[model samples]
Target: MSNVTSGDRRVRRHLTAEIKSSLRDLRNQLSMLNRQVGIQLDLKDIDMDCLDLISRHGPLSPSTLARRAGLHPATVTGILDRLERAGWIARERDPADRRAVTVRALPDRGKEVYRLFSGMNSAMDSICADYDEEQLKLLADFLRKSTDAGLTATRDLSASGA
Candidate 1:
């Protein structure tokens, strides 16, 4: 009843396997790079991760930041305090409600982080040079979808019995 030819199925399976392997390699390499960056910044790995999320997501409440980082609110508080002291983030009152707090990334003071990541950024740019606009769009689409899938898996994992 299947319309797919055996040869076509074989090629698809091969490509799928290769994509999975490449994803694993990319994850490991990025993890190592993040660890190195954390070390250089003298920050805990989780703190670095939280700061990254804050920077990318712009202003966020402490609770929202905790959820995004998959950390406890108390733990995020400590991370925020440390980051605040380090001049990496600012914690302030929300204008809409004085009871609520907002956390903002102080990117101007994060020049060193940018400097440290410049090499990797340049390398990525060089790699992207080989791709045409359409290919780049396709690559971006794949990465975005893959990221969404990973996030979904993470959310669903809590319901699964280990």
Candidate 2:
């Protein structure tokens, strides 16, 4: 019959529901935070996703950025075009590979953006500051693993669909 143990089944069902709820809440929080950041930066139409990608692995080619951002190459190109026009980023030819291009953030602008992001993050950090350093490290490790697993699942699902 069923392979599931009663305790395991209950745990799985609870965890699945919890994960969905957590994702929804996190998404909403991010949306609100992005709106705030946009207003403060005078970038009313900023795309948070693009900012996130550049913040993480900038100075990367559009193709490499696409892969890292989990977006299509053309989409990355469009985002880069806008960012470049906004004077927030620049694209330069790779020194060794003339055919390839790399995207880099304007350091001064990047610092400003980082300040905005860090302001929001500081509030979050303060909330968790009661925890000891080791405890915080463990929490970070847990979050990292969860993020990796979620990315893996998304990749697998897309591959299966293809």
Candidate closest to the true structure, highest lDDT: 1
Q: After superposition, how far is residue 159 of candidate 2 from its true place, in Å?
A: 1.4
Q: Estimate, for each residue in 1-162, the C-alpha lDDT of model 2 and write its tens digit.
A: 398799998999999899779978987988898888888876644345666676677777788887876778887778788778878888899889999888887788878778888977898889788899899999789789988988999899878986
Residue pairs in candidate 2 whose N, alpha carbon or C atoms collide under 3 angstroms: none
Query: Candidate 2 — what's its lDDT?
Result: 0.80
For each predicted model, how many residue pairs clash, with residues at least 3 apart or on different chains? 0, 0
- In model 1, the clashing pairs are none
Over 1-162, each residue of candidate 1 has an lDDT whose tens digit, in order, gives 399999999999999999999999999998899899989989888888999998999699999999998778999999999999988999989888999999999978678889989999999999999999999999999999999999889878855844
- Reference-based lDDT, residue 4, model 1: 90
Worst window of 10 by summed lDDT in candidate 2: 43-52
lDDT of 1: 0.91
Q: Against the true structure, whose TM-score is highest?
A: 1
lDDT of each model, Cα atoms only?
0.91, 0.80
What lDDT score goes with residue 87 in model 1? 87
Query: Root-mean-square deviation of each candidate, in angstroms?
Result: 1.5, 3.7
